[model samples]
Target chain A: MIIIAILIGCIVGALIGINAPVIPYTYSTFLAIAVVAALDSVFGGITSVLKKNFDLTIFISGFFCNSILSIALTYLGQKLNLDIYLAALVVFVGRMFTNLTIIRRYYIEKWTSKIEKDDKELQQ
Target chain B: MKIKIKKEKLVMSITIGIACFALMLVMFMQFNMVKQTDITGIETMRESELRLELSSWNEKYNELNTIYQETVGKSEEYKNERESYEKTYELLSKELEQLNKALGKTDVEGEGIVIQLTDKAGTQLSEDVKVKRITEEDLLIIVNQLFAAGAEAISINGHRVISTTSIFSIGEEFLKVNGERIVEPYVINAIGNPDYLKSTVSGKGGHVDALKELGHETSVDINKNIKIEKYEKELHTKYID
Candidate 1:
């Protein structure tokens, strides 16, 4: 039932998003940075869930805050004539990689333990 | 307890799903905008390929312009040649007219005056008195006066006076004009404006009055149409340029 709800929500949200009008070229850079931040947040959420410590409120707040902070930084960078977005990108991508590694390790360990238990049962 | 957990899970999954959907949508839109903004797709082209295309197009334009200039030059040359041909044709026709006039091959006609000079009537002259008649000298004077008055052509008794003409006395009653014998009364025809020719001859104390005073009967008449025959003598040039 949970999986069905998630699937329905994802499909509906995707449909709405696909039909939405594109933003102006000037704001696209901010959107790109926000997207990167959102992706990092998603990976972080997945990693936390795999570790059995996921908090819905924290995940939601992180997703929105990270995107908003990155966009604000990009605008400030334009005012200052600095490439602050590059710094933000680097940090977000690095965290995403770390989260991805954690997720990968959790899945590998779970799969290996399941296989080991099956072998022990067969030996008995 | 199981139902409560299941409800909580469902809510969390829905939220996560919505976030994921939003992320995907933003990614698609950004991708589309970037593709549209980069129209030339220059990022995909190598530097050498761009330079080669630019140089080839420039060469093509230069070749086309060269061909255009060559055609323009050829047309200009043809125009100059045609103009030169027209000028030469005009010059040749003008020379042909001058040659015809010099050769006296053209029969000419124009508005002019005719003068008749004869001896005084025999009834008015006694046998003892010397009778004055028109002579070669008198004829020469009249011809010179007519030429000074802008006569274009002159003839006396059907004989055309060209540059080679000779006037002399043939006998006491006959005169030679252009080697042709002419008798009195001598008829002189001159082609020119009749008004100016008449004024030149009949003016006060002019040549006509002078001839009348010399006991020669003279009459002047203005004729609108006067024809002069072409010189019939064969011309022989001893020397020419």
Candidate 2:
């Protein structure tokens, strides 16, 4: 059921995205910020799940709040003639990388331990 | 315990799906934007591309020029329509004013004369001679004479004399003009040429002289300004279709 739901949601979202109006390039900066923030939140959610400390409320709230705050900052930056969105982009991307590394290291260690146990049983 | 775990997993999956959906949507939108608009510096363009850009801009300018001219024409048409509407408004207002004047619907003033008629004093007459008090018939006769003398407007005892006016005796003690009881002194204001009005009312062989002969108090004053009030009642016509 869960896999089917995700597949449906993704397909529907893709369809809607294809039909969606193309935003002007000037305001595309805000979209970029939002996309980066959401991606960072997703990676963070996975890392928390691996560490057994996941909270759905915290994950969703972080996702939305980060996006909104980043957009606001981008607007202020434009008024000040500065590229402040770039700074936000860097932070979100950096956090995403750290989360990815944590997830990768966790799965790799789990797999290696499982393989060693299986080899000992085989020898016995 | 297994059911609870399944429910938790279902919740988590839905949340994850929503997040995935959002990511896909945003990414696709960005993809579309990137595909549609080429973000390149103007100085890096080739000569041929620059000429094509210039031609497209000129075409856009021509389209915009036609639109601007069409808007200007529409504005001029609206201005003319407003002017004509204003002219019609002015004409209707003037017509309303004139109709009101002719219908005795408004107070009027001009060079005219005031005729005041009072009952004969008891002391001035002998005991054998009976005083003929001023009656409504005498008023009607005098009003007719004033209108005959080209009086534009007239009033008796402050009651406007319109086309529907009535002058008659109610009882032995009171006379009615325009349905209101008028007493001893009747003030008649007539708006017209003062000399003509005076000559018609108080002139020799006029109704005023006849009243004086009947021992009634009569006086006519030529005035430069005499105001006659409008009729108090609303004029209605049910018979006219």
Candidate 3:
């Protein structure tokens, strides 16, 4: 049921976004940074869920807050003639890598242990 | 117990679905925007490249401005020169017309007199048979008298008299003025003061009265407007320097 809901939401979102009007080139920087922030939050949410410490409130808040904060930073950076979005990108991408490592380890450990248990059961 | 667990799982799924929905929406929107934007457009140019492009355009604009100013100045100069040229042409043309008038090369008009001399010796009664018919010398004397009275222009029998004019006879048969044959009655036109011209050619000692006593019919008329034609023959000196 959860997978079906997620699939439906993604498909609907994709359809709506495809039909949406294209934004100006100047604002594309903000959108790009916001996407990175949202992707980072998603990775973090999945990592916490695997760790058995998932909070729906934290996930939702992180998703929206990160996107907004990054966009604001990009605007401020333009005013200051600074590349503040670069800092945001680096931070988000680093966290995403960490989350990915955690997800990868968890899956590998579960698979290896399952194979060992099957071998022991067959011998018994 | 089963209902509570189902409710909790449903809520979690719904929140996750909402989060994913938001993410996909923004991601796809950015994708479309970036896809439509031309990567090679000025918007995407680096700062240094934009600066360079702007500077070159400014240089080109300044060059064109200089050229435009120079072209305008040149046109103004040409306009002034053309105006002066037209003025000189007009002055020269007026002077040439005046010179032609003075040279007797153009027709003249003024208040003057007309004289007609009819040689009636052939039909005259009791006239001396030896009184020769009107001669070139008689006509020449009358012309000389009209000139002395300030006649500005003169013509005889349609022949204009210029500085080079000659009055003579080809024989006793015909008279020649400006080398063209003329017969009686000789009609002479002289442009001048009308009363002055008539009085000079007539009266007691005048050539007309002298010719009248010899049986030639002579009459002088004062005219308000008399036109003397221009000299047609070209005047060129062969020996005079």
Candidate 4:
């Protein structure tokens, strides 16, 4: 489910990037997607607060990271004058790498360590 | 007792699932908002720039048009001055021609008169004429025919209608005056001998009558002392030299 969610986010970001060149319509569509993404993030933050594990820095960092990445990607694409498809590809690559790194470090590696420590303590 | 334990596990799993989903949703929503703000900011800046560009273009166009109309407005005067210059040249040439003729030279003076037609009253032309309107092509044909009949000086409605003159109806009421706006009762005036000019202008199947047929009345007046005035310098346009 987490993988699917990440895939969906990346896909949404890519689609938004691809359609960014279409003048007037681009403005509305860009706003709509960003709003939806922000709402989803807010929902996550609320649940964390409810669970009493709320770290504003962590939540804020994630927010800034994705927003900055998306904007930087767009700006870099324009600065380099890349074609639309090429720009979309760049955004996709950037998003995928960042998401995978976060997931691996936070979920997989940490969980495996905790589980291994628990098994040793139980045997002792 | 076994059933109660299973129910407790089920409740815990459901709660965890809901909490996680809600947490994810919040995170995504916050990120999305920031991204949108950035994109909109960039777009707004770009749009403002485009508007400024468009406005500048319009200003330049208006400046040129003002210059053009001012120049064209004084066309009659320019034409008169040009004719005077040409006349002096012609007289000198004629003297030379006479000398050359005496010396068995084949040079001869090319004599001709320029005629112009104008409406005495500044009344709007009749419906038929308004419907047809005046066209550059029509003016060209008239000028060409006059030149063919040996016309020397040519002007129309106080404006030295040139090769570039485009006569087309503008909007619902006005005519395009040098791509600017102008109203009707266009007067066509010429400088030439009456007898020869009348005969030459109105002779055979002519366009003068065609203009009349369209309903905007046309009167070909012959002026023996048709002293066309000198054109004052244009106020808007400038010259590099």
Interface RMSD of each: 2.2, 1.7, 0.9, 9.0
Question: Any runs in candidate 4 off by more than 4 Å, and if so which?
Answer: A1-124, B1-131, B161-182, B231-241
lDDT of 4 by residue, B1-241 (tens): 9989767655544443443443344334434544555666455665447668779989999999999889887897899999999999999999987664333233222233333333333345665333355555556667666656655445454444333445666454555534545444555444444566566656765667666555445666665554332222232435645
Q: Kindly list the per-residue Cα lDDT of model 2 for residues B1-241, writing each as its tens digit.
A: 9999999988878886887788779877977776667757543564357779999999999999999999999999999999999999999988998888777999988889999888874535776877777778888999999999999889998999999999999777788877888887889999998888889888786898888888887888988888889998899899999
Candidate 2 residue pairs that clash:
none
Segments of candidate 2 deviating more than 4 angstroms: A1-124, B1-51, B121-128
The B-chain TM-score of model 3 reads 0.63
Q: Can you write out model 1's per-residue Cα lDDT over B103-157, one digit (the tens) per residue? A: 5666888799999887663434556665566678878888888888888888888
TM-score of the A chain in candidate 1: the value is: 0.89
Who wins the TM-score comparison? 3
Flag the better candidate by DockQ, 1 or 4.
1
After TM-score superposition, what is the CA distance of residue B216 in candidate 2 from its true location, in Å? 2.2
Candidate 4 chain A lDDT trough over 10 residues, lowest sum: A25-34
| lDDT values for all models | 0.82, 0.86, 0.88, 0.52
Which lDDT value does model 4 have at A9? Answer: 49
Candidate 1 wrong stretches, greater than 4 Å: A1-27, B1-14, B37-241
Quote model 4's iRMS: 9.0
| DockQ-based class of model 4 | incorrect
